[model samples]
Target: MITCQDILELQLDGVELIAGEEGLDHPVTWTYMVQTRPFAEHMNQGNFALCVIDYVRYDFEEAQRAMEELYELGISGFAVSVMEDREWIPQKMIDRANELALPLFYIRWEGASFVDIAQSVGKIILEHEIQNKRTGDYLYNLLFGYDINDRYIEKISSQFGINFTNPCRVGIIVADRRYGINLEQDEHIYEYYANYLN
Candidate 1:
């Protein structure tokens, strides 16, 4: 549930907003900093991509293309550091980002460290993960009767967003090792297992 707006509110190292105001609400699941080529293929949905254009001379055209490619790859936003040439990012790139509604940020290389931004975003992601794990553990305990009571069940279920009124069933499956069937190799394994359970 961490969004670009949350990062902006952090006011990380006085980071400046460049464009894409409409995408402030876009959800960010993770943050990645890249200075190398071929970045988009490695990214995931809801990723916040940070471009470090650190070379003595930078190619604005390639940077623009990469931004568009990252946006198409489903990134929530993009951040870039100022080039060595002292040129603010080009107006066309800002216009393109605005047109695409992909949030853009300008963090000067001297003004902020990548570690600072990463740590701030990483904290939010880690907290969400920890909360999810806690919810899962609570559900497991309740289902297995670690503490079984109407009050406890209702409270725990609501906390984890589980609707107890809905009919539910628990299932367990033991895979046979003798067959040497690799689930990854066999597309039919899921159907076979379902048929066996039924």
Candidate 2:
């Protein structure tokens, strides 16, 4: 659940918030560069739309409309680059953003480009998703015997740098619920077990 606030922590240069400060905590599902397409098919809940602002630079109404449309689709937020000596973001756009509680920000892009921001954010999200998938698979296998074949086992072991030939054992540690082991604690325990097995 990486949120706009998480992305902001990266402190990208030239990027500034124009409105919707309250929406910073909303979780971002993915980041994508905006294109001419309608964006309905590509947009999903928690999407962060990144744009160059070239298309709506001259039209304030269009920019406001675009923000409203994106908000309707459950987009997490929007990021736009405001190049030097170019048109600035419209006040209406900022107003609409605050009204909708959608996070909106402008990137100065002094030397950095929109692609750089998109790539960095996308990479963080991609890695998070991959880690989550691996966790889910590992938990599933642990709870329900290894329902996979040998080939699958070999692949998993190779990916995780585990040697199948070595002695392996699974230890189930039961925690007292009264002690209140949170999810973060569980992950640490899992990690400890994984390292111990290796």
Candidate 2 lDDT over 1-198, as tens digits, reads: 578988888787777778999999987766766665586756666778877655445245655666677778778888877546277787777888898888898887574577777777888877766766676577568459745687877777676555569785766555433334465545534543343232
TM-score of each: 0.69, 0.65
User: How many pairs of residues collide in model 2?
Assistant: 1
Q: In model 2, what is the error at residue 71, expressed in angstroms?
A: 1.1
List candidate 2 segments past 4 Å from native. Answer: 55-58, 146-198
Off by over 4 Å in 1: 55-57, 143-147, 153-198
For candidate 2, the C-alpha RMSD (Å) to the true structure equals 12.5
Clashing residue pairs, backbone N/CA/C < 3 A, model 2: 14-108
lDDT of 1 by residue, 49-95 (tens): 88866554336777787788778778899998865436788899999
Q: Say which candidate scores most in TM-score.
A: 1
The C-alpha RMSD of each candidate to the native structure, in angstroms, is 8.0, 12.5
